[model samples]
Target: MLLSDFIREGRKALLALYPAPEAGNLMTRLFSARLGLPPHTPLVHPETEIPPASLDLLQDDLDRLLHGEPLQYVLGAATFCGRDFKVSPAVLIPRPETELLVERALAAIDGAGPGCRVLDLCTGSGCIAWTLMLERPGLCVTAVDLSGEALAEARSQFPDRPAPHFVRADVLTQPRIDGGPFHLIVSNPPYVLERQKAQMRRNVLDYEPEMALFVPDGNPLLFYRAIAGMALTQLLPGGTGIVEINDALGPDTADIFIQAGFSDVSLLPDLSGRDRFIQFQRPF
Candidate 1:
């Protein structure tokens, strides 16, 4: 079977679940991942024949997509901060927006002395933690997650490089981390309200881990409150704390840090200009 024909048929099949452009993109991604070809190959080499041995595998991947499984989970990888990180149902697939959280955290710690301590709470897939350690190389990072499975996934990334110390502890309940007095504290913890679940698509709602994605609607700022309290004690004087937040709750979330006595509390926007993150600093 030709690559182009596969893409055409796959896209048509996926259209039942996705819009035209997205369906086409999913087909392209499946083709690229399975065949080890560039995404553009299907278009450029329309007549290229797919190996008979590989045809069944490609179809199986497409079937997963049709069943509303996220392509990242099917492939066992998700690209974050320009590197592909391992992902599974055990951890949330890293999102592009969270890259901004890492950028701001790095900027906040720039010019710091070597071995600057950093803490990452609810560190799913360890994307932010690993990226910081890899990009700066001098910082000491400790990351925490509640799920043993999630912690294992985080620890498994970038085997050749040193990983942040991963601890299994419920972020909302843990009072203090052992490695603290950190220069920076960061998290992309659960902020999605349970009520908002209906607004989400099946790919996310059905496939992503609920523990990493939701909170009680009655108290949606639960994780923020806990992180704020942790920062007050764990952060070094004049240290910074940053986190990704649900867009609709920006001001509300910022207030959590402010009321916790963090100075320099600021609500930051993502590239789309939505209130997507909150940053705060411990007073000197």
Candidate 2:
């Protein structure tokens, strides 16, 4: 079959499960990748023919998508902060809004000298930590997560550099990892309330790991509270803390940071103007 024909068929199959434009885009990307073609390469040129094995792989991926699997998981990778990172059901898929946390962290340390220490809490897939290290190679980084499977996926993304010290401690019960006295601490921890689970889309609610996305309904700010409390102890005086939080819980998160003694507390919005990030400085 022609590549264009296969894409049209794939889109129809995906639409039966996903009712958004993303369904079609996902199908196109997977189909292109299976064909050994770059996602942006033209599909139908008079000179090229589709490979049989590529068609088989595309068909298999379409079946997975039909069952509500996230396209990123199906593709085994995700793009965050302009870099590709491996992903799996064990880790939460990185979102664009989380980039705000990284941006604020970078801006907070804009003039800092070399050898500054950075910490990324609940660092699933190592997106934030790796991005920061890539942006500022001089900074030393430590990334922590409670899930061994998630940390393993994160480790695979950065094979060349010394592997980040991966700790398997719950952020709420044990927040301190070995490398600290950090100049910057950042997190995009589980802030989604249990009640909010019913409202999430099928692809996310069903495919993404819940441990990385949710907190008990009765205590929605548990992770934030825990991380902030630890930062008060581990962060260097005047160090920065940046977190990506739910828009609905922004005020509460800021209050937690304030209560934990972080000064200059401020909430910032994502590109869509949703209240999403909080940045503050530890008092000297």
Highest-scoring model, TM-score: 1
Per-model tally of clashing residue pairs: 0, 0
Cα lDDT, model 1, residue 82:
95
Writing each residue's lDDT as its tens digit, candidate 2 over 29-55 gives: 786656667665544463455687676
Best by lDDT: 1
Clashing pairs in 1: none
Worst 10 residues of 2 by lDDT: 40-49
TM-score of each: 0.98, 0.94
Candidate 2 clash total?
0
Off by over 4 Å in 1: none
Error of 2 at 142 (Å): 1.1
Candidate 1's TM-score reads 0.98
